[model samples]
Target: MATTLDAPGRGTRRARAPHPAPAVQAPTKKYRLAAAGFLSPALVLIAAFVVLPMVLTLWISLHRWSMFTPITDMEFVGLDNYRAVVASSTHMAAVRNTVVYVGLSAAVTIPLALLLALLLYFPQLRGRGVVRVLLFATYVVPTVAIVIIWSNVYAPGYGPLDNLLALVGVDSPGWLSNPDAALYSLVIFNVWQMLGYYVVLLVAGLTQIPEEVYEAARIDGAGPVRQTVSITVPLLRGALVFVLLMAVINSIQVFDPVYLLTQGGPVDATNVLSFDIQRTAFQNGLAGEASAMAFSLLVLLAAVAGILGAVRRRA
Candidate 1:
């Protein structure tokens, strides 16, 4: 046998050092304590402002609590306030008006916003930035200031709108006073005020749609109208859902315009749920009833949200 010259211990396998197990250090008590400290303030705020208020409102809704009376004197009226609200014709009328306002406002505002977004989104449009700023300016403006400015425009005969209508040999109705026209006039004002916000939202939605999709559509011989109808609207469902829900809620809670301009006006043309709640609470001195109304409004909003959520999920 030929014995090969080999280094010492070459025939034996070298002993390998075992790999160290990953260090299993537990979080220190101090680390947990620090996290607790960071979370405490936000938890406290939610408990105080949100949770506490909701609990108290529920409690008050169960009783006939008066602002003028002592807490000890409060009587448990159960659902009498809600029953009364349901039974009242005025409340029913207010609900109807609110429904109409919300419906008409959404119908008008959404389409106008969609159109404006489409127009402004075009690459060939000039001064697009300036126009967008001008449109959005109304949304940032104070509600009171907007009301004041529009009050003049809605003024009878001598106002800008009235003058313009007169130039065309048309007479202007009293937008703030006439029962036939007041609610619709307010709807118009609301649409104008909110148009820019929804337009901005839709424009944002438009930007998210990839340019290649439109290019592909064009190659398929789809014109602008076809592209918008077939592609744009369907892709914009998410933004549209948000806009629709917000529009309905805002319209339902309309108070300032009715209060400031009409005060629920001639034959209560503009008496919405929010205005009704305000009048019940402060003006009519029905605190419990107002609380019930507030809760009812909350329920209405919840129902709307649920329906819309279901639609979105189905889509």
Candidate 2:
């Protein structure tokens, strides 16, 4: 405390020092232990399912192991598995098809998702709830059911698609039979199956944008398109990035439809990486080569994720 002289007629006044701000306390040992205890299950599961498998795969990729034979009897063939994968014509075709699939899927899905989200969000339209539910239900339905439905839809003759096309004066080209149309037909199937899911994801993102932003834009005399370009799209970047990443991952990992419907058939027209890896390992019994392919896919995904993360950080 300190005293200062007031006016001669007034008594002296006392002043006190200000209090210091409190420091942030570190977590106590008990708190830390509790956190670790809560996290242990997830950590253990990841170790067992993901990390250990990746390590074992890399080790196996260095050996020429017939999957049926014991690991101990394997011969070392470092880098040969990778070389063989890189050199295989079918493998290369799968890679090319994957690139096209990912690109085409994202191109169609993103814009459509955004458009549907905007429509669903901005308007208080009737039956919106029912529509949303129906769309999303398609995504959650069993893959076997989806494949069966699509198979019937794509049936060459007496199929609704072909019959409908005939009415429009356009002959239905073979949906899954012609190699030229097979991959494309699969892309269309993919779009129909996943469109609802993407739309919901985008709608959730749309809800995060403040209504006040749109209101302000209107006050400033900005039109709908201007507001979307300036406010909606810019604010929705995080969600857009996630949707694109998911689309690419889903496209690349496509296997079920190929396996069930086409059997990677019509002359391997629908051959994708996942189905190819399955065929290489289980059918051909080249475990090491299959391991190499799987590991390479892992690396590709990591690289893509890294690139997207870097771009997000920069932006």
Candidate 3:
């Protein structure tokens, strides 16, 4: 600053501090190259496996093709395949089943998982580790193996479950063979297979809540149920959101059990979107239509994720 008189007679001035020179930056070209090298493999894999297929699917959705024929043989059909998806009764049923399955799975899995997590979080609970291991084993085992085990578990007549039901004077519904019960049976299998994973996630969330908070609640006469409703639920919202998203995605993309057990069913009952897409593409030789269905699924997932994000932000 220029020297200034405090008053015309005093002629006092404020002193300015000297500025420091800017620091020299080291060359970042090599650092950036090393970083790129580290990320290259993941980037390449995602591009090749995820991006390429998605682009190919989108392109194919705009054309007509059969897997048996050469790609050169594909004929441009614009949005006819998409129109077919909208018009087809089987496609509509698959969509409905997918929505219902996701809804039912979330309803059954979230609260049950929360309850299991609460039980498991008790520090003095005996055999909790063993119980956790057994529960998670269902998830860690190959999905194919789980489906095989469940198939027998749901077997009619001579099966253990059926026999037990018989002893109790309860009838077996031929779980996979009854159209009305087939989809529900698959839902039950999914809940059993995925329950442990969600419980483990919720348990992790529970641990982050300091014990002092719970102690304070108890001192204030908060019961277990009250603590869970006010403290636990509010604090664990982040984990619950994650679990909800995973459950919805898993439920919507479910295919293995339906494929292995019901093969899209005693009727069209267990015909979910994923199975329907696979059947349409390879089994029925309607690649174009299948691509359209896949694209539709992609759209649905994106929309749902966006909505969830909005809700999360609002909350």
Per-residue lDDT tens digits for candidate 2, residues 243-314, read 888888888899998899887878888888999999988999999999999999999999888887776565
The model with the greatest TM-score is 2
Tell me how far the alpha carbon of residue 297 in candidate 1 is from the true structure, in angstroms, after superposition: 0.3
* TM-score (C-alpha, index-matched) for candidate 3: 0.88
Give each prediction's root-mean-square deviation over alpha carbons.
Answer: 4.9, 2.3, 4.7
Cα error, residue 229 of model 3, in Å, equals 0.9
How many residue pairs clash in each candidate at the backbone level? 0, 0, 0
Tens-place lDDT per residue, model 3, 1-315, is 545548677678776768889899986999999999999999999999999999999999999999889999999999999999999999999999998899999999999999989888865778999999998988999998888788889888887888998999999988889999999999999999999999999999888988899999999999988998999999888888888888998899999988999999787898999999999999999999999999989989988888776766664
Q: Rank the candidates by lDDT, best first.
A: 3, 2, 1
How do these models rank on TM-score, best leading?
Answer: 2, 3, 1
Error of 1 at 282 (Å): 0.4
Candidate 3 wrong stretches, greater than 4 Å: 1-38, 310-315
lDDT agreement of model 2 with the native: 0.90
Backbone clash pairs for candidate 2 read none
Please give the distance, in angstroms, between residue 41's alpha carbon in candidate 2 and its true position after superposition.
2.7
TM-score per model over all chains: 0.87, 0.93, 0.88
lDDT of each: 0.88, 0.90, 0.91
